[model samples]
Target: MEKKELVMNCTLALHGCRTSYDRSDLDSWYLLGTYEYDGSKLYLNTLDDKICYCDRYDATPLKSWDSLSAMLTSEIERIFGLFDADGHCIDEDVPTTPVVI
Candidate 1:
């Protein structure tokens, strides 16, 4: 995915907040989850009815959203596989799949 594609994916994922007066409101927009790249690291925040998952990665600075999205997607898949229906980790195994944004 390119920058546009990553942006579009994030936008679509945040559709529920499109009508909100403050699109930048983390609480409203991140009801599901959010990802951020801070030059040297990637951060993930996943919120659900039963739990919230927060993680960070000390990764190389991504030059494009393509890389950023790839990392985010991969982390998300890992999170999903690690957790059970109740948001609890099922096992110690971590996911290695590269999910597209």
Candidate 2:
């Protein structure tokens, strides 16, 4: 008989297409991903020339969520962000949460 071992690497990411405000750019894709425990990340639309930019912080510890679902659910909000009633962004100094503002 022979001995064998299995190795598993769990990783997940979500992507979607969004149209740019400028008429020349048209549409582009954005990303949000990797397992929460595996250091989840958010790549959003940039303000300047770059299409996308990384929104992760070294000091913040928003990764390592309880489960895969929780990670996905929370990270999605980084795209929408904490919007106010008047459609403005609400900034909070919470490390565990995303801050698009």
Candidate 3:
């Protein structure tokens, strides 16, 4: 895809998150990270950089932003349940930004 289109898609895929793209050579844009959402499953690169889809529950790989978002929301809910109503996670430790490629 074109750089502009790829940037736009990444932006949409990473809603509520921040991202940065590298275009050092003008011929390519590199998304820096091991985690990526490719409009399908959330992929994690192994130590050797082999792409692997995240399937936490042994269910089908996540196939859309909605599914990923729901999973995150559920996790947040579970974490919140562990604390009192007014408790909040540490700001710096929480992942407020996500990467999409």
Best by TM-score: 1
lDDT ranking, best first: 2, 1, 3
Predicted candidate 3 versus true structure: per-residue lDDT over 1-101, tens digit per residue: 55434433332232323243332333221122222222333332222232223332332333323344454554345434433433432343433233223
What lDDT tens digits, residue by residue, belong to model 1 across residues 12-86?
232132365443555521333334321122222322212222333432222223333664564555545544565
Cα distance off (Å), candidate 2, residue 73: 3.1
**Candidate 1, position 34, lDDT:** 36
TM-score of each model, in listed order? 0.29, 0.26, 0.24
- Give lDDT for model 2: 0.38
lDDT tens digits by residue: candidate 2, 39-93: 5454432322222223345423332444435545655454234434444334544
lDDT at 87, model 3: 44
Best lDDT among the predictions, by candidate number: 2
Candidate 2 TM-score to native: 0.26
- By summed lDDT, the worst window of 10 consecutive residues in model 1 runs over 37-46
Q: How many angstroms is residue 18 displaced in model 2 relative to the true structure, after the best TM-score fit?
A: 20
